[model samples]
Target: MYQLKESRKLSNTEMKECLQISKSEFLEQINLECSGCISALKDFITLNRKDQFISIDQDIKLNDDLINSQRIFKTFAKLQSFGESIKSIISSIFKKTAPQNNKKRCQLHSLKQNPEINIQEHVHYICNEIVNQNEDCIIQDKEFDYHLQNYLKTKKFCPSCKENIQAALKHFKLQVPQPDCACSIICFIKYDHLKCEIHIPYDPILLNALLNKAQIQPFYQHASTKEDAQEELLICIGLLIKDRLSSLYRETQTQEIIKYIFYQQIGEIFKRRLENYSKMKGEHKSQLEELEQYLKKEVEQKDKQKKKRQLKKQKRKEQQLSFDGSVRANYLQESSRRSISPSNSEKNLLKSFGWQGSPSVSPQTRKELEFLQKEHLQEINNRRKQLREQTKQCWCEWCHHHKQK
Candidate 1:
């Protein structure tokens, strides 16, 4: 909130903290000091941060000296009542030195020599009787020829003499003649037998009809791109309009009409193109939708076929499991009966070794055989479980792939 008001006054404590001084020092330096003195002290401290106070003070003194000097000069001028005489004096000095700096002589030396004569009358007489009459300075009079030679000298003249010469030569300069009639245009036909050239007048209306017929002829169909064709057609039409206007109307109002017509034609072309684009877009959209529907139907059919295959595989697995179980039961029963009754070869070998009656199966041996059979059955069950798990993972992976597709 304190920061919100940039011009907020600081408290005495805040001021002391900012100044890094005790209360007594702050009071001595700030409270008792005049506002100007305080501001001056603050400026001195600010300038002294980079040890620049001495240089700044010297600069201030120099500026003060400059201002005082200007004041003294102004006062002195006022006391002297110079008014605007200083400018006149400076101009007079330049004028006095000008002739000495410039060494160029006058072209019309005769005119410069006879300064007391009527220069205007002399110039008028030379223009009318000599220049206009002969169209050149081919004078029969020796005195006039001498003056003309002086006028034609290869030397620059002073400003006054140059002015007189320019006045005299003004008659020879090409001047745009003012039209006697209001409309300032002059039309004429010229035939040059040397060039075998003849002028033929063309009918603007007939040319316009021919141009219109040519414009209507189909050419856009042969162009590479529609936009290029349109641009070319527009250029041709614009050129045609320009040519027609050149001989028909040459005004800004008609130019505006041509522009409006051009823009209208462009708008119509763009509108037709936009409508065609929209129609094409619609057709493409419909085609894409049909493709999507067809793809969906294919996916459904594939899923059904996969489900049928999985069901068949599962049925075959179940049947194989049941058959294996029955076969295992029969095998276990046969092994038990064989264990209870010794084989004939084993009985003969026992008899030869003086074994009496049927060899009694040991209880330990029976227990061991049963334990082995149980282990084999557990192994078979584990293998079947692993096969079932592998089938389940394969099915899951197929489903994931199908979903992605």
Candidate 2:
């Protein structure tokens, strides 16, 4: 609990640095509590184990049921030969002497011609039932008879035949268990191309015991997510293989697990993650490219708008500095004509009319000059106002864009 709390406070990178661990190790430590991640890991490990074992034990490929059924058939054939040989030898001994012990031996070998179980009745259903049930599939007397007749066209099996069936069932149970076996084992054997019997590495009882252990029992928990399932898969494989190593292989020198299962089986548990990973990677790349293009184009458009705004500012400044030289010349000429000439007025006006010559321009010329100046000022004010508005608008747009980014 203390470790879990400490792990929570530290960032993943910080934790890794403190522990001096690789990225994979750091992530694995974090997901130890996550259920779905554990489940998925278990699946991969199961496939891997199957692959590793099958390469070495290719001789046994078929399911327990079919193999058991064949054994019954073979045993029945052997019993027939044994009965004949014993009878022939006993007949010669009887001819030599009236032997009570010989008669008893012949009596013991003789049977009432009634057989209880029929091997031919449900031959096909055996493998399917056993494999589907996993390592712990059990075929009790009642269940065996039911499947036998259910699959086969025949009616019922005799007592003599029943004995052979029971023996075969016992043998099958030793190889495969009655309950709690992982589905992966049955799948491995059922689909093998060779379809023959392979050496089972563990005893049925031992395998069951290993499976029931608390640490591994959780591997059978239902997975809500693919990652969760994967985590469980990896853990289950690791634990099982570790157990197998100490029990059967007896070698701790080797640290790596064999990955023959990856080559041999592409089961759903193993294949889903790979498919999802590839698909997600492709989607991520395409989306990233789209974002980059959009950002680049937006930057380019902002630059263009800035250049246009600067050009408008320069044009407004030039218009403000400009003056109408022709208008100014015309105004001066009008002013000169409107004024009284000094030469014409000074000779006679002082002696004859005693009128003083006015030096100021006329009221009409002064009013015209004031009106022209007002019009020029209004034009300049309008240009300045337009430039101010453009600059303000540009600044507001840029602020909004930055905020969004």
Candidate 3:
């Protein structure tokens, strides 16, 4: 019976046949005895009885057990189908959401035509100009040219300059009279050198204002041969101004040009003040050396005083030790005198009494006392022995007389 129950629980068909019962009867018995056993059998049959077909009963006590088994199989099949559906959905969403390319989008165009002015570019340009003019100077020509080209390519013009250049380039003939030369050499020259000769591309009034701020004259002046000294001085002044202007111009930004120009104008106004600061002589540097020596002397004096104090303390400690040693020696001498004086006197008194200067009895006196004690003990023992012998002889005599009677 146990074997049949186990077999039914295991869903073994041969064991099921051995039970000799219908499937409904077996399931009913399993349900009555153990619902878990019936469920386990249903699961095992669902897993292993793929080839065998069995009619499931709707009214069976284990109805949900069997239905759940079929439902699990159907759920797996639907999940497999859903995997494919999910892939399709993802593909469709990717297709619909993918970015598109549009080729006809509008872009902003710059209205001004001229290239930008860059401060670094201006520095590179000035550096090139200086190098070209002064070939003897130790300057790397190729490197400078490379830097200048890079500067030109990367340079951007200020908005004002761009507008002015675009207008000038657009209406070149109408604005300025044609020059004798292409003006390329003057145009490419350093700004300081071309200050009075070049015409800035702006309105005449604005150009005048720019020149005033730039501290440049309207036109280059020709020197008279008769005024050679004055011409030489003016040339010197112009050179100085040109150098200052070039340095400031290369470092100044377009937005800061006006401010830089104003700064330069102020610098010129205080030229004497600046020069005074530069030329003002300082006190002799040897004064610092003297002060250092004085400090050294003060430090040495302090060190010497410290050493003197240390020496004085050491000397006081030595003197105190010497005094203490003398006092201890005196105390020891006094104690020795007191202890030895009494002991020596006692020894002399003992020697006078015919006794050794020691606290022990003489050997002769000790032997005499011991001999007297031994003699007294011997007398006592002899008396006791004699009395005992007499008493015993009398008792023997008395006993012999009574026997005769």
Candidate 4:
């Protein structure tokens, strides 16, 4: 057993040699027909004693034949678990040893009948021929699958498929698939060469249903390269024709000319679209004109109101200034009269008493009188000048009165 444990750590060649020796020794000790069971015993003992050796002589007094049989069963079980073609052997073992329950019997039968199914068989078979033919065949397959799936989702036919369908439709008068409904995956595989007796027959319901499934709608042609130049020029010509027709229709009321123009424009639907767009633009322009007139009227009214407020404020300020000037003038006149009247009586008394008095006036009073008179005249002149300046600058009712004077 220790030797068997040691053999487990050996390389494959050394281990095989040790196993052969073990097998020979077991068959000799057993004294039974060597039914290749000794080889299984060697293998079993080696595996069981891999981490620790068993004292086979002391622990068990089993006959060599019994040990050999037990090892054979272990080997059979291991092979049944791992071998691809051992399902029948396992089923036989289970029928002889397993409990006689219906469920267990059914399970055993299932294991025997269906061995392990290989999921990769279909994938490998589909790709094997291509892989054998080309060195980079796997990469091409992956790219094709990617493009095919994208074509399915986008409803856009591959270039070759589209060209084939276009030619078929043109030559045979068969209807081409509408742009929205063209599922390249299904169409390429199934319907690229579909036949119909009509030329460009429209099928709105079927087309819309397929488009919904593919999650795509008709896309407008984009003029991104020289290849699209002819289409772009055609669109421009259509626009020009629509504009001329619209102008003529607006300028003339003749039914015959209008009918001719309508028929001519019908061949180019893009021209009709442009005409509708132009009419919408004209309606927007008329609305904008009305808004501009309303805004202009509001601005003029605001300006007039602003001017009226300014004139009213100017009139109030001028009235305050004139009232202030009049009060000042009246106060000055009263003060002068009081000063002169007192002096006049004093002078008359002095003259009748024959007293020689110096005009019966003090030098201070004369000086005060002179100062008051000068101040009054100066104030009057200043008020008149202020009124004249205000009248020149102001456009108010009070200032206008001053201006007329």
Candidate 5:
């Protein structure tokens, strides 16, 4: 009773003394553990005193057989333990590394096949994790951990599964270091874009359309593994929506337009945004931050180009004004030169006719010629004045409406 209960061994004589019982009585009263112990003890120490210390060949052979039996049992036990350990090690390796027959799809696929699922909760959690990452800059801070704890209790969830996925989400949930993983971060950015940037809320039709489009995009269709491609897609989709809004339907409250845009732009936008993110930040970080940096770089580049264009435009305008001023200066100079009166010899009609004396025509004829000359000069001056007025109307810097009529 003491050996079995206390999980310890005592010599047969000690056991007998403690029980105050004989060997025969102990044997008769033995339980399961005590019987096994007694049997093992008897096998190891056979009390064959028939040849005690006599050094007989039979006695030595029996002792050798007993030692061999014990040695065989010990070796067999070690081998059994080694085999079990190898089996456990193999099972663990397959469990951790295998992809469940290669059927496991990413979060997008989960959302896609089961469109009826309320992703609003997932979206809410993503946003909360991002908004409060604590002082550690680690996304899975105490607050986030507490929220997850609260969430698991309040909300029931089965493991994320598909035709490809066989394991429970809890398995990966424990393994992932951050609650704000790429997929979740992307979802948070989408929520922020919808709520903060677009300033619209509760558009069931539009939200459904966007989510469905996300599943179809290549970025979403790709298998979720080591790579964080969902973040790329999220940035692209958000950008696409914003670009669509700014370009086409900014203020219109139309769900149809959003749906149309969703289908039209998702693929192209996904690719473009992925390329941009790779160019801007490489694979350094996997959060909304990668998208943010890409967008900031794009904006800075655009601003730089815009300033360059403005400067070029300003330079071209200045050059054109300078050329116009020089042309006008030469024209005015010619006009002033033309305004001088005719010389004395050019005013005499008699000189032109080769008559030296002033006796070829009557005063009335001269008066008529002078009147004709004055009228011709007046008409020429009037035409020049009209041309100047038309040029001013067409080319005047202050006249914005000159091209209208």
Candidate 6:
């Protein structure tokens, strides 16, 4: 607690200068606070072995009176309970079997950290190839998968990988935990294309343990803004990864592991973005098809309406033609009747006047011929008036045009 207070009061440079240590040493000391606590707890348990065993080697026995009467024992019990709960949570979150179990390789694989090559250049080259390669050829080539498995189990590594991991650790202000204290094992694999299955070791460090008032101080003294909060979170993640890397990977392999993890994350992010884009593209295509179908239906309906209008127009034209033909035929028949009737009337008048035998005509015969002529002229005038009225009433465009002319 006093060390923590001193750390809070001093800057990193000041702490290093005062402690007569380098920056790396200072970072290592500060980051291992949780590990130190675990060590201290183990020591305490060992010291109290006369009371009862609290470790997994034996079943734990509790005495109510001893727990209640002794404050130290009560505190120890509570701490033990808290530790167990933390272990449970960690187990649930990282539910994969440890690499030591030698289980089926598939069962041990994690999608987060799988890589075929830990070297940056080679990994980049493969990614480029994947992008440029045709889909048909890429699917047929199964070599990528075999190389992917090799990265995880193979001990061989690029010479520069360790240097890269060390640099990363320095930049993040983190240190690898001592091998003896590492709770999880991580195997970093690098590859271009495969199911993402990078085995990221679970860090045993608990957030609650770090945040405990009786233990180490918080990562940030005060995260007042959103940016500060995000920065603090990043710092916490770095610390956890640092702890995991230190314990899981040998000094020689640390660089490869870190590189693999870095590239795996990038690949996962890219894959997710591609999946999202594909979904959007599919939706767009479906919308276009729907629009096309709707337009086609609309056009078909319009055509049907157009055809109906044309049929109605043709039917009306045929009816008009039939009506006009009947009217013309009736008019022609009436004209013929008038022409024949005039001749017949002339014949009748001559017969009535008795002009066949006598040249001289009587006054009565002349008067009768005058009356018959006047009657015939009146009948012809009436028929002409009726025909003119019927023509005026015709509303067809062809008939109206002729009437106007």
State how far residue 235 of model 2 sits from its true place (Å).
Answer: 48
Q: How close is candidate 4 to the true structure, as a TM-score?
A: 0.19
> For residues 1-405, could you state the per-residue lDDT of candidate 3 as single tens digits?
332222233322322222132444444433112233234344433331221112233321112333232242332243234335433432322223332233221011112221222223233444444334332211133433344334223334344433443343233223344345443322211211222222232122322232333343324233233233233222222333333334444333221322222222222322222223223311233567778999999999999999999999999999999999998897666555443322454444446546563343334433543565466568789999999899999999999999999
Q: Report how far off residue 269 is in candidate 2 (Å).
A: 3.8
TM-score of each: 0.24, 0.25, 0.17, 0.19, 0.17, 0.23
Local distance difference test, each candidate: 0.39, 0.39, 0.37, 0.38, 0.37, 0.39
lDDT of 6 by residue, 107-225 (tens): 11332343322222222232243223321111112432344234323423243433333343233223333445534221111112244222222222222222221223354354444
Off by over 4 Å in 5: 1-287, 340-405
TM-score of 6: 0.23
lDDT winner, 1 or 5: 1
Encode model 1's per-residue lDDT on 1-405: one tens digit a residue: 222121123333332222132223322433211233333334443342212111122121112221232242332234234324433422322223232222232111212321222222223333343333323211123433344335324233354444444443232122233435323111111222344332211323322332443345443223334333333333333233334333232222223232332223222332233334445556777999999999999999999999999999999999999999998897767656664765575455456557686455545545654565567679899999999999999999999999999
Q: Which ten residues in a row have the lowest lDDT in candidate 4?
A: 51-60
C-alpha lDDT (0 to 100) for residue 69 of candidate 5: 21
Cα distance off (Å), candidate 5, residue 151 = 62
- Ranked by TM-score, the better of candidates 3 and 4 is 4
Off-target runs (Cα >4 Å) in candidate 2 are 1-266, 323-359, 362-405
* Candidate 2: tens digits of C-alpha lDDT, residues 59-152: 2122233223224233223423443553443342222323333332222122332112222222223323323344432223454345444422
Off by over 4 Å in 1: 1-257, 329-340, 344-405
> Which candidate would rank higher by TM-score, 1 or 6?
1
Show where candidate 6 strays beyond 4 Å. Answer: 1-261, 338-405
